[model samples]
Target: MEVVVGVDLGGTKISAALVDESGNIVADVRCHTQVEKGREFVIEQLTKTVGELFERAEGLGKRVLAIGIGSPGIIDPDSGVVVKAAVNLPQWEGISLKRIFEERFNVVAFADNDVNVMALGESLFGVAKGLKNVIFIAIGTGIGGGIVVDGKLYHGSTFTAGEIGHMTILPEGPKCACGNYGCLEALASGPSIARRAKEYIAKGVATSLSELVDDEITCEHVAKAASKGDALCRRLLEEAGRYIGVAVASLMNVLNPDCVVIGGGVAQAGEILLTPIRHEVALRAISPAPVLQSLLRENAGEIGAAALAFSKLAEKD
Candidate 1:
């Protein structure tokens, strides 16, 4: 059996998996990113994890072909270099991930933004399977997205095509981390949801959400509270959903994709969040596509990275 290694490197953790060509996860391993330990340290962890997957694949009589990485920030796919990353990655500027991994493992390597990889996974094997056009949105600490068109992942000329979160939504809305105002991320991301809750609590509005967490509240707390019918939390999440819906509707009109897939931790809010988004899209889009949750969930990135490796390997044939 032929297999490839896919590594999903995030701000907090690193997950590596051995995946077959058909998208089955043969074996997997994970470890802390320990970002404070610095870039080389994180690279070591990634290498060690891939080594473990390699051993496991060999034990199972699978031949390893290549390696692929799904990581944060803008990646130059041709160079396998991370041109820039968020603050969470801490000094991850201009790191040549592809060359390092290729030299370390003595195999061909491929890399792209993490969310783009997730879209690739979903398009090829998950909810968007057999579809030629798809959009994937990951709502977490921040919102990131990926676009797949004509059955292939679309990387714009600058390789920044899928930055759905940064789209200016309100024009005069809240300041975003990217120095933009009224970005979809600034209004609807996980941290944005928490911030909305905090703003409401500071206004002395009565709510059960404040009693749930001692420190700065999280989106999860708000989601749970909304699930229990906390009016304030419910309203906040619904408002966020509306903002997300507006953005998605714009995407639908522009791209006309087969579907939109929502994923990431914050998406766990499920129907409480999706219902409002659907309503807003219905109101806004000319002809809205179906908005679906990611079927692969957390494994999408790793699986997509493996798919990338497999695709590259096939090109050589």
Candidate 2:
């Protein structure tokens, strides 16, 4: 069996999987990313994960082909370098992820922004399949996006075109981690949702969510509470969905994409979130398209990474 390695590298964790040509996972491994320990430690963790995958491949009579990495931040997709990123990964500036991995593993490698590859995954195997124009939104701890136009990923002039989270929806709302006030991220992301719940609790509002997670309340807790009919959590999620809808509506009006996809941890809240997002998009959009959830979900990152490698390689051929 021949397989490509796909890595989903994030702030909190790293997941690597060996995938065959048909998108089947031959083997996989994951580990917590102690990013605070410095770049070298992070590299060590990646090496261990990949090395384990290679070992498993050998044991399973598989021939490893190449590597694909989906990492957070502005990656030079053509060159496979991490140009810049947020504080999540510390001093991760100007690192050539492709060069480093190819040198270490002695194989071809490609790297890209996490959400970009995820969008690619959707285009290839998920909701946006066969669409010429598409938009993908990730609503996790933070928010991010990817855009495809004319069946090609749009990198924009600066390669940062899809930072949808920074779009200003609330002109005077809460400050985001990016130091921008009223960013969609600060208003609609998972952390933002949890923050809203926390704010209500601070105001002495009565909600069972407080009893669920105490001061350590998270977005998952809010979603869980909402599922159980907790009115406060439902209200918070609906508000976040509306905020997301505003942004999505804005994008749809400008891009006129055939499809838009919502993925990431918060998206798992399902219809509670999607319903309001749909309502807002329908209300505000000039030419509306259906908003749908990701079919791949957690697997999108790794699968998309593999798909990224395959696509780039095919282009080379």
Candidate 3:
């Protein structure tokens, strides 16, 4: 059997899996990123994990075909280098992941933005499977998106097409990390939601959310509070949902996708967030779509990486 290695490189862990063409995992390994140890350390960890998978695949009599990776930061798709990285991946800039892995494993390799791989995974196997046009929004520390158009991932002219989080949601509102005012990430991302909760506490809002956390407030705390029926937490998440909905509604009209999939840690809040988002989408969209949570959840990245390799290999063929 011929299999490809699909790797998901994250701030905390690097997961590598040997996946068959049908999106089935033949072998897998996970290792800590140890990001604080710097860029080379993280790369070493990735090599170790992928090496383990290679051994496992060999044991199972599977021939390794290629490697595909999904990682954070601005990637040069052609070179597979991280052009810029987010804060989570310190000093990861300019690392050529594809070059390193391909040389190490002696196989062709592919890499791209994590969310872009995620969109491909969704289209090929996950919730959005069987759909021709799909959009994937990941709401976590920040909101990122991937757009699949007409059964293919659209990389735009410069290979940076899926930046749904940067869309301006509130024209004179909060300043975003990208130095823009009121981008969707600023308004509805996990940190932004947590910040809103902190703002409420500063104003002495009567919410039990503050009592639920052990440290500085986090989106998880708010989500937990909302799950427990804390009115303030519910309202906070719902408000974020509404903002997300507004942006999604705009996407629905402009892209005309069959569905929009939401994933990431913050999306784990379930209906408290989705309810408001769905309502707002219903109210605002010229064309509405099913707003659904990711079925793949934590596995999306690894599986998505495999899907990326499959797509790229197909293009070569």
Query: Model 2, stretches more than 4 Å misplaced?
Result: 212-214
Tell me the spans in candidate 3 whose CA falls farther than 4 Å from its real position.
213-215
* Residue lDDT tens for model 1, 279-302: 988998888999998888889889
Clashing pairs in 3: none
Tell me the spans in candidate 1 whose CA falls farther than 4 Å from its real position.
Answer: none
Compute the lDDT for candidate 1.
0.89
* Candidate 2 vs. true structure, TM-score: 0.94
lDDT of each: 0.89, 0.90, 0.89
**Worst 10 contiguous positions by lDDT, candidate 2:** 208-217
As a TM-score, model 1 comes out at 0.96
Number of clashes in model 2? Answer: 0
Candidate 2 has an lDDT of 0.90
Error of 3 at 93 (Å): 3.3
